[model samples]
Target: MNGLIGKKIGMTSVYDSTGKSVACTVIEAGPCVVTQVKTEQTDGYTALQLAYGDTKAKNTSKPLQGHFEKANTEPKHKLVEFRDFSIVEKAIGEIIKVDDVFNEGDMVHAVGVTKGKGFQGVVKRYGFAGVGGATHGQHNRQRAPGSMGASSYPSRVFKGKRLPGRTGGDNVKVKNLKVLKVFADQNLILIKGAIPGHKGAYVILEKK
Candidate 1:
């Protein structure tokens, strides 16, 4: 109940009460079904497992198919467990909508995977200014990561160096994003500024 499974529905801009334009990220939140309810007596902890997005049963595994059947719901594409959920009375198979948890102006956190940019340089990945300019016969070194280590002191690149190999595709949690608008009828929530992940990527919106 503290959070809901959602899909990033892209971004848009809206005007506030002061007529100021504000950037917002649209998220299709909830209508998620409670697939399982864990209790301290049974599971050693309290949690609610919510499932969202429909999936074909043919593509689902036998164990997951039986799990969905136990909940009396169709196969879902995404399942997230929220520990110490605010709504403990929610039974399995109960539907939780976007309006059930969030409201306009509420501060929330968005957790998602960022977009992947593979095999990048330090300039793009870590904002390094790169090597010196092309002047003085410095060729093909503009975007290179310079001076990895000393010539003989260490002789090797130290661990955790900031040289880029892969970029993005990280689990990021953007905290305290204000809920700009909530269209419960459409099950969409507009949050202020940008959240992590690409369009259609799954995200978790948690109450702050």
Candidate 2:
């Protein structure tokens, strides 16, 4: 379950060796520091707690400050756990880079929050075709979820019925994205296909 915490750097099209443009999402992966190493004997699970991104000491809490200090690193804005990291032997305070966990042509998955669309209607949220042939005052009820319930059947609208409500802003996982390129010098990674969330959104990438 080796993985890395990264940030979405936006999308771009890159040409492969065959000279065909391939759309990909650029990500800034780590040089993540191992903040804590959990073991089955002590924590009931095996996981590596990694920290990434620079942060001012004053902006971080005292508890987090002590944690980073134990690892002998500066305060990091993002902290993620990679459970059962089996790619290699990792020690406390060790550095793991993008290339260390992934390589070109490797199949991977990305997890992140989808872009929030805020409140939405059934037509846009659930792709409801909506009522048609505006008849019997149906014009105004086109998008409305017609009839809540039968007069005397269920006696109430059924729970979990699809209706107008908030859309997006959920955890989305895009699986089997190819590792298009890796820039170890700049700590940037290019993954094939679109990933959810806006630019600068935190993303978790793990090998499939």
Candidate 3:
């Protein structure tokens, strides 16, 4: 009710009412099955577990297979729980489609994992300008993180230094993205602007 599990399909440009081209991200939002319902009395919380994307039963764990069987549905690749779900009365195995939750012009928040950029330097990771030009013996120091800390005052690098190791692959939430279109027949929704994650990655779209 409050949100739905979705997958990032890709990006495309659509013309708005003003005939201006607007870039949008396409998402396959549900046809998700209600897999579990947790009540405050039972679990000390109210949430609805929704499952999306199909997977082979052989690839699914036995416990998960049994869980899906209880809902009268096949194994799913992604399962997300919506806390304080608005539709608490939805029976298990009820399908929540894109149109059932979102409408065109509605604002929503998209939560996803950003693309992973492994082992990057500060220049790429934190958008640090390279250390000056290639002159003055600064050949290898161009992309190096300059002046980490005072050598005498702080013998070691600070805990939260800007020096980069791993970059991205973070759980990110982009808020207030307007819904451009919703195709219930195809179970797809087009959202204005970009969201996190790569194509085919799972995303959660929450109504604002």
Candidate 4:
């Protein structure tokens, strides 16, 4: 699938043709450099290794420093490969902008890390209804995760139990978001609906 690495620029509401307020998310979508191209004959797979976001030489590692040098580009903060990626006959060091692939009314899938909610209990994390009512001497066990397993038969807590230890900070995908607008000049694309990740977080926008 063809895609681009973008940064979430937060959400805004815009009035549609019917004068209805539609919520949308703004993203700075590429101007990404094609650092490497993987071919079937050479790498046993087809992919486009694209890089975005610039960084200083002192901040980049030695291996990556050499990589950007081969691409004839500056040090970048982000690099991702699109397996079986389709695009123009782009060579190494070529830049791919948002307008090159996407347009208004296009459907896309946005993937990114969700906002971290830190440590939480079952009620907040898993939406588990705790033992309700202040009956059966239930005092402060309202938000507790009740009976995990059989005491003697199954002594240990079973794996994949929905007991909350940590919440959020997971990679999530929001699919079928309609591209409401595309700004080639500014390298920005507005999509309908909320996407995963906080502001400035990197998101992968995949064409659907």
Candidate 5:
């Protein structure tokens, strides 16, 4: 899972070489700095700690300021650990460009947190059919989930029942998405189809 921490820059449509129109999401990927490299001997496992997005010096805490000092880079707004590869071979402060790991037409996997929709009802969250009749003295109960349990049988609802409460804002991983294009100068990566989460949200892209 050697990948880069990136931001979704929204989506657009592009024409492929075969003259086919393709819809894609644009991501502003790294240029991320290698902050720390962990090893089994010293840290118990091999991993690379990458830092992306910049934070103003004044806005950053003193502790983080000290951490960036060792890397000889400014404080960043986001820091993530990627363990799939031995990134420790890269020196501290070493930069990983998106181009180094991916190219156009490469299959990729992306992980992101979806937008939060807050509390939701079963009809919207679980695709429940909801109340059947609109008439016959039914109004507010139209969206209700009807009976939730057997009256005197089990005496309780199942643990994993699909009753809805909170919705969205979950970590979602989308796999086998194709990379439509790569713009190195702008750090923009065009991915086929929609990605999870809203524009400007952070996402991790892995070569598949």
Candidate 6:
């Protein structure tokens, strides 16, 4: 996939050319540096390793420091690779801007880790109907799972049964989102709709 790394800068609504309001995710996309280029004969695959977000030398370890040195650039907060660079032709230390690969009305995909909601209930996690009788005789059946297993027929809870436990904090991908705007001066690329993860979170943007 043709992609780049970016930071989510929160969401906002914007009016399109037709004066239609659209929800958009503001992202501080690349101006990423091409750290390394690998070819089939050398690395057995064609890819360009990109680095984004500057990090101080004091914060980076020696091995990572050397890696940045190989790129002849400062330490970066993240690194990712793209398979094809024929359209980019980026060299080591070459900067990649958001406008280089994305523009208004272009379809793109974003991948990010969703916000965590720890230890959810069956009703909240699996959308199961909770035990009823809120007024009759129920005391605390509102959020209970109620019947999980059969009485004597099944002594133990069945495996793979839908039950509430941990929730969210998972990798999620939002696909075919239209690029609403690309602010090259600010390195911001706005896409239509809400994206996974919170503001300032790292996300991967891929052209779809």
Residue-pair clashes per candidate: 0, 0, 0, 0, 0, 0
Q: How far is candidate 3 from the true structure (C-alpha RMSD, Å)?
A: 1.3
TM-score of candidate 5 against the unseen true structure: 0.91
TM-score of each: 0.96, 0.91, 0.95, 0.93, 0.91, 0.93
4 against 5, candidate with superior TM-score? 4
lDDT of each: 0.94, 0.90, 0.93, 0.93, 0.89, 0.88
State how far residue 78 of model 5 sits from its true place (Å): 1.4
Residue pairs clashing, model 4: none
Find the candidate with the highest TM-score and give its number: 1
1-208: candidate 1 lDDT, tens digit per residue: 3999999999999999999999999999989999999999999999999999999999999999999999999999999999999898999989999999999989999999999999898999999987888999999998888888898788888999998788999999999999999999999999999999999999999998
Better of 3 and 5 by TM-score: 3
The global Cα lDDT (0 to 1) of model 4 is 0.93
Estimate the overall C-alpha local distance difference test score of candidate 2: 0.90
Question: Model 6, stretches more than 4 Å misplaced?
Answer: none
Off by over 4 Å in 2: none
lDDT of 3 by residue, 109-160 (tens): 9999999989998999999997888987778788877887787887998798
Off by over 4 Å in 3: none
Error of 3 at 153 (Å): 2.1
True-vs-predicted CA distance for residue 142, candidate 6, Å: 0.5
Candidate 1 clashes between residue pairs 3 or more apart in a chain or in different chains: none
List model 4 lDDT by residue over 44-127, tens digit each: 988899999988999999999999999999999999888888783689999999998899999999999999999999999999
